[model samples]
Target: MYDIKALYEATSVDDACRLLKEHPGSQVIAGGSDVLVQIREGKRAGKELVSIYMLDELRGICLDAEDNIRIGSLTSFSHITKNPIIQKYINVLGEAVDQIGGPQIRNIGTIGGNTCNGVTSADSASTLFAWDAQVEIAGEGYRRVVPINEFYIKAGTVALEEGEIQTAIIIPKKAYEGYKGHYIKYAMREAMDIATTGCSVNVKLSADKKTFEDVRIAYGVAGPIPMRVPTAENFIRGKEVNDENMEAFAEKVLEDINPRDSWRASKAFRCHIGVVMAKRACEKAVKQAGGDVDDRTEL
Candidate 1:
């Protein structure tokens, strides 16, 4: 067995940062759901563990001064799913959170841990990336923020360096207003399956019910990272979305997606599902943004 030391608890972000500096071999542990599993599987063996879940500064969610919603790094998936603000507005993100594990895991697994742990299959990440979310990094000397897309360097890899902790996630105000989106997770079963296929769509509604505006679509477990679907997005942007635009967008999904492994689903299955999901999301969002009645909740 590997030798290890547990620091018991951390009271605040400042306290946690200090401990991280003092214990060079230590790894910050919160939500223990992911880290504990890794430790048991021998995927990681750190000399010390600093439990930070108790740190008040690292938990909670709220809109910041700029009206951008900032989700505390330690905020649980349950919190994300239950927050009326998130549900009433950023429904795409709320939908993603709802799919994360069962009730037990949802109560404990956190967004910070999900992003930092860097799992390819993390469901929340796809929506976060789609929104061009930003991350607040806390450290001893200073704090800095980076866009979510830039935060992850690679699969299971991130830009988090020495003495830094992901303190919060910030979603810009505009991304939250006049926005509509849908998230679909193609798993073996809705209850306990990792996404074989997952997709999120975000669209900016034009004041007039005619033209489509900014569209952002993304997928998970499809490639090395969560990414915007460029080809499909471009196909429908600025156009008067209709059955024709949806069909064209669907065609683009086939060309745009870059599938990696085969487990989530066969390449063909994911590609087909990606195209179909994108079309459905685009139609629903366009309808809503234009102030029309479209009762389709495709997710």
Candidate 2:
């Protein structure tokens, strides 16, 4: 049961910021997918909610003057899956969101909520991390953009200050250029299941598409926060995309992830699956970048 002392419908981003400032005990709600669940389960602690679901200013997918893809905080997963801009440039994001839940859940879950929930298993975080996305935040009188990887301080905790709201997510143009990415979520079931482990790989190939120019590898449910494996990425960078190098890269990834044992999966299992998922995701990304992958080869 939702025991709310008050509910304020914010008409704009400014209004939402003002409400948060005025009511320090109030929490912000857009899609309410995560918050409502938390509230019902007695996990979240606020009686007052400032609703930004109706704030049109905080919704949409567009490109800024600098060609950065800006996704409003209130943009739902449904819109994200169908948006041509997302489909064309950052379809890996679309691919991840599409697997989130049933259609109804996707229709109501916002990207902001997914990130703000700050769960290690959030399906979207690893993909966004691979793209090197930035988050735009708005407060009473100031706005700031911070890299997505830096947004999380710990599990279930975000860097948003009091009275601040995330306004949009920004993916720089440079992050998209020559990048082909893939995201994979491993769960017990196909639907309505949180990831036991997830991996996302984005690779930039050389002009000839034979060698990796830049590579990013990230994982979810692998540590205290969504993690990027720099050691594995460094090993793969400038290397030929072949069975031997890919296997070496996969082995090196074990040095980066720090998954904990949970009821759903053991730490050893998570690490083992994480390595496999990374290899598969990397192979898919390499193939998407127009490189040949040998399925017969095992990493």
Candidate 3:
């Protein structure tokens, strides 16, 4: 095991920021679920632990009077999974959180840490991407906001600059008000496997369900990053959820996702699963949008 020069449990945002500046080499830890194991496995190394859990500024789940849900950075996945606001407004996010690791891991892992870690299998990442979520970041001079889709530079790396802390994750109320979505992960096993491929679909459909208004799709574990499926999304928008459109949408997604080597699954299987997951997720999203699509119909 590696050793750390110090461990700081910051009680406030100012205190946390001060400690972070004092030890530039320090790594911020909230849940310590993924990071601690990564450190012990020699995947992540650091000399200090700056605990952000005690920072009251980084803890809580609340709804403002405006109906927008404001989630603190340190909010746990379990907390998010159970939050009624999340359930009612961001069901896809809640669904993704429920499938992460397990109840015990969920209880400790923070939603902010999951996406900030920037791994492709991060359960909540693509869900946020589908919803057009925004991450709030703060640093020395001021704060900045970036859409969730652009938050990661690469695997295991966040776009957050040095000394900056992600203050909150603001999921806009508009994304949730009249829309609905579904998240589907294709994994070998339901319990422990990372997604071979995962998809989240969000849509606003006509009352008759014959046509769609707005549509969004995001695919994970398909490329250098978890990403939005723009080609697939474009094909589904304004199109009827018929067999022809489903096939066209699947073909569209095939153009974008090419899976890579992973210990748990083969590339071909991953590719196949991505296509299957995308189709199913899209259908479910359309249904949730109050669209009248018979899922039993062939694609």
Candidate 4:
């Protein structure tokens, strides 16, 4: 049996915040995709739970006044992939979350839980970073926002306070405007296995479609936290979009990533894959942006 001291169902966002404040050691549970599994494995045994699964206020995707994409924290991966707003604006996010697991897990795994868990290998992590997403948090009497890059402190750690809950993930209009992106992941088993390495690349091409106006690239499992490769991004900006420059950009990305040795992959192997994935992702993104890239390039 699963160990639990108590369970409280929150009726709304305010109720969820109040519950967290009232129960000192309580943790919010949505979808139970990750929390329940951890509890069964004894990692979170005897934990007090604040169930937010029924809070309709915390589930949907939409655009705010500024045209920023706001995704409710409790929105599940399956919902993300099917959401028209997601498809029309940030399809890279949908594509990234789609790779989380099989149909069942996608049905229950939420974007909030995926990001809040603070794992470097979370499928959503790299794309969020590439998009320069922001985390909106709510607590007893205060609300604040943090950039996705700053939200992740390190492996298995995030900047969330003890009583705060994430409300929405915001992708600023400036971050994704005039850009298209792609995500690439390498895992032992394609379907359900955790990613050994993941890369996300986004590009904004010049009007003539001959040069990179700007570029953003990020990686998961490349270090202790999901990180952007500023060195590579800088190199690609204003450069001609051709195979020679693309290959150079890919090599420059290796200068920033710091993958480690693990059972899933070696530091060397992850580093190698990082370069390959970066190039492939960039190419796909460039093509999406109408840049001149080979149509037959193997992804």
- Among these predictions, the greatest TM-score belongs to 4
Per-residue lDDT tens digits for candidate 2, residues 1-299, read 77667899987778888999899878888888877887888876557999999888888999999999999988999999899999899899999998898899899999999999899899999999999999999987789999998998899899998889999999999999789999999999989899999899999999988899999999999998998999999999999979788888988899989999999899999999888888888889889989988744232
Count of backbone clashes, every candidate in sequence: 1, 0, 0, 0
Ranking by lDDT: 4, 2, 3, 1
Q: How far off is residue 24 in model 3, in Å?
A: 1.6
Instruction: Put down candidate 4 lDDT per residue, 67-118, tens digits, no spaces.
Output: 9999999899999999998898889999999999899999998999999999
What 10-residue stretch in candidate 2 is worst by lDDT? 290-299
The number of the candidate with the highest lDDT is 4
- TM-score-wise, the better of 1 and 4 is 4
Candidate 4: minimum summed lDDT over ten consecutive residues — where?
290-299
Model 2 RMSD to the real structure? 1.4
Better of 3 and 4 by lDDT: 4
Candidate 3, residues 1-299, lDDT tens digits: the string is 75456789877776777778988878888888877887888765556888887766676777868766788998998888788888878878888888888778989989888888888888788888888888989875587888887788887788887677888888778877778899887777888668767788888887777887778888788876888888888877888767678767866887888778878777887777777777777778877777766665221
Pick the winner on lDDT between candidates 2 and 3. Answer: 2
- Candidate 4 at 112: error in angstroms? 0.5
Order candidates by TM-score, high to low.
4, 2, 3, 1
TM-score of each: 0.91, 0.97, 0.93, 0.97
Off by over 4 Å in 1: 1-3, 290-299
| lDDT for position 185 in model 3 | 78
